[model samples]
Target: MQKGSFIGIDFGTTNTSVVRVFNDEHGYKTVNLGEGGDYPFSSIVAIPRQNGGSLKFGRDIKNHREELSSDYEIFTSMKSFLGTNKEFKVGDHRYSATEITTLFLKYIKDYISRTHPDVDLSKAGLSFPVDFSPEARRELRTAAENAGIKVNSFLSESTAAYFANRKAGQAFSKVMVLDWGGGTFDISILELKKNSITETAVFGERVGGDDIDFALAKRVHAEIIKKSEVYNPVAFEDMNLASKDYLISWCEKAKIEISNTEDDYESAIYNYGMYGTKSITVSVNLFNGVVEPIIKSRIRKAVDAALGRANLKPASIDAIVIVGGSSNLASYEEAITNIFKDSQVILPDKPQWSTAEGAALMQIIGGNFKLNNSLGLYLSDGSIFPILKEGEHGVGSVIETLSFSLTEDTQDAHFNFANEDGVMFERATIPTKGYLNEIIRLSARIDDDQIARIQLYNNSMGDLQHSKPTNVEVNKLTFYYDISGLK
Candidate 1:
């Protein structure tokens, strides 16, 4: 095992998957760790303290939620809160969300280290939401660094899925990635052109499986409230005795059963209660005439919103890749197919493994790079930076900025300009869908006046910028800042 064999970690909201490149008799294969597989790690985390000290981490934490007091910080859905500058309350000591996330990551790292005692983990690739900002990425990097892993770079979820598909022998020219994760949803259209992949536009919303689960829980509670008042005719307090976990677990199981059953099941047990020595089942129903529409509506709106953002009439996309655990539902996939008419939405083999596998491939390929063609500049070598002015929306006009870097003793670095097609976003007239129309076009000018500026800064003197390595590229050096919304 080399010191820096890039490991891909898809630390998701509902489930976490770790993938590493492994060499076997069948050649190199991406190994995905699941339960009971030599390396057993669950995303579930429990922070119960002994003698008032918080439990560091484990699957045991979520299992003991009802038994733990306020002192025990049993947390799930931490993935939803990433990039949000919020502090978590665990007993009297409060830690930022980023800090809590790092703790969980540390737990995973320790688990891996113990499993692979001989391997050195210097470089790791982390997966993030498509909508994450540069600041959010910096925070993620900081968290991973604190957890004792040196994060090499950040990979967008769709980007990771894209690579995963490629590794599985699926090829495409222009693709659309529809990812509905546990806590976040994102849709992106990418172009695979001229030996490079470019993400054209990305639309992300904080709505996914977790939101659906919450909706189900709320609906079940309401139904229980109504049923208890009419059927039991006792104090309302007595009817609330069932544990929340039992209800949610039953509901989850009921959901799975409904998705799998060929015959229409009429009723479902919402919760199971223990009475002295025996357990009793509290049932609910998906076939119930009243609540089915509520569940359907949520799923419908989310899907419509995702497709709308891609600005693609379903027929235009070459292929729509379904990702995230929620996409497994037969109903959801059917809905997507119905919406697209003739186009096909292919679910990659091992849908859950797609993102992590893709991320590992991204680690080998590096990121998408495009020349800043908007800036009409004729440059031989150096660094490029965009200057900006604050506008009404946020950052507006593009102003030229200065950048400096070090050149090697014998190598010459060539400065290149790369730009992506600009996106024009316009809100749709319809209220149900979040947003509408967007157009993508590559606009570059060869004129010397509009070219983006590139100037190299060197800490080590002697004016050696011209003599540096010519093999060096500006994917690392050029900085892109969108100034459209600003004044």
Candidate 2:
């Protein structure tokens, strides 16, 4: 690595930011590169000419969203679509998912190289969702390599934010990092003492800023139908279809407006050439009333699941730090404030930048701040296992079928047969036997796009007052067989 400062690139769902750790005449500081010296929208490669010749990347892409859509190429929010089977098309040309991401990453690399010609591009740390599958991480690594940067490590988004917050001078023993980003929402409960971070538990849902946008867009459709004077449903549909770009753009703005306002709202609606449009103001109460419960349900469930996994009481949490674009919503902030009435909810400045900034902070802290001894598992015997016993170090055996959400279905997901907690099982190949009275921790690769979820001891604890239901989507499912006794 070069002696010069390194860069922290937070390639987010809605935006991307690049932060450099540099020392000037005054001292050390982290400077954000791009618009107004702050985070830049994570958009790149927009086609400008209706015929498609040159493409616009980054901030420039957003500036020319309209014209570029006509002739040039526009690839915005490509991050959220990663790992999906979707492809980007400009004119008649189609690109594979990873190729699209590469072009964007290359733009960032070129920007950095232009700004700091002498800095080393090798050994860069990339950030991914904590629950990202091994396959997804590999794709990201490949993307960075294609961008001409040698990736040294890939850390979870919340893990990066945890260290970033610590570097910014916040300290806690049991800190809950609630990172709601542009594309994903992850809540990580860390048993932090002094400067070290021990991840006690982690839970995440695919719901995020994109979901919020979708929700708001639905609301806008309803509002327009209710208020449009020329409201011919078929006509309106045709217009919107013809000018899909305009409706989407407007929906983006409406989402922002709802995020900023708390009262009934009104705005002149612009009509796309195909979608005949007019203006309408939505009652503040109407928008909030409809979306509030949905938002609360998701956030509460995710946060509670992580807390429940850690087996910690509400009072045990010392601080709750909300990170990500969705976390900035006043409704979310108010909800957290209401839950942890006594504990403060810390929201970082330029909230979206925290994860990438945190990743850089991890560079300074090294291996000490990570999850140690945390194991994932699957059952080998045709017996039910318990989740965890009261005060038990690990999940205890229960009498029910175990549900495992495997990400890639890889070898790392297997466990050596064990029935006891003290005996550490050695790594073995497939067709392994399960043991009785033995405890094993297993982690697996379930699929190409999703993270692996192993079924540990099942906990049939009765409903606790603070227990929140989590909504997770699993792409692959498997069962646990307790072959512990057989082995």
Give one digit per residue, the lDDT tens place, for model 2 in 216-258. Answer: 6556666666554544554334444325555555655666677
Candidate 1 to truth, TM: 0.66
What would the per-residue lDDT of candidate 1 be over residues 1-487, giving only the tens digit for each residue? 1223567777777767677764333445666654346332445555544355655454554444445534465566677666677776644567776787788888777766777665445557777776665445666777778988887545667667766774322356657777777777766666654454555545566766666565565555555555453453433233343354445544555555555563343444423232112222323344232234533565456545555644555666677788876676665676667766665567886777777766665555433223222332223243232222111111112223344232332232233343222222111111111112211111211111112223333322244553232221111111122211111
Cα displacement (Å) at residue 148, model 1? 0.6
Per-model TM-score on C-alpha atoms? 0.66, 0.73
- What lDDT is reached at residue 28 by model 2? 46
Best by TM-score: 2
Candidate 2: regions farther than 4 A off: 1-4, 23-28, 48-52, 115-123, 167-170, 229-245, 257-266, 273-275, 368-371, 374-487
Maximum-lDDT candidate: 2
Global lDDT of each candidate: 0.52, 0.57
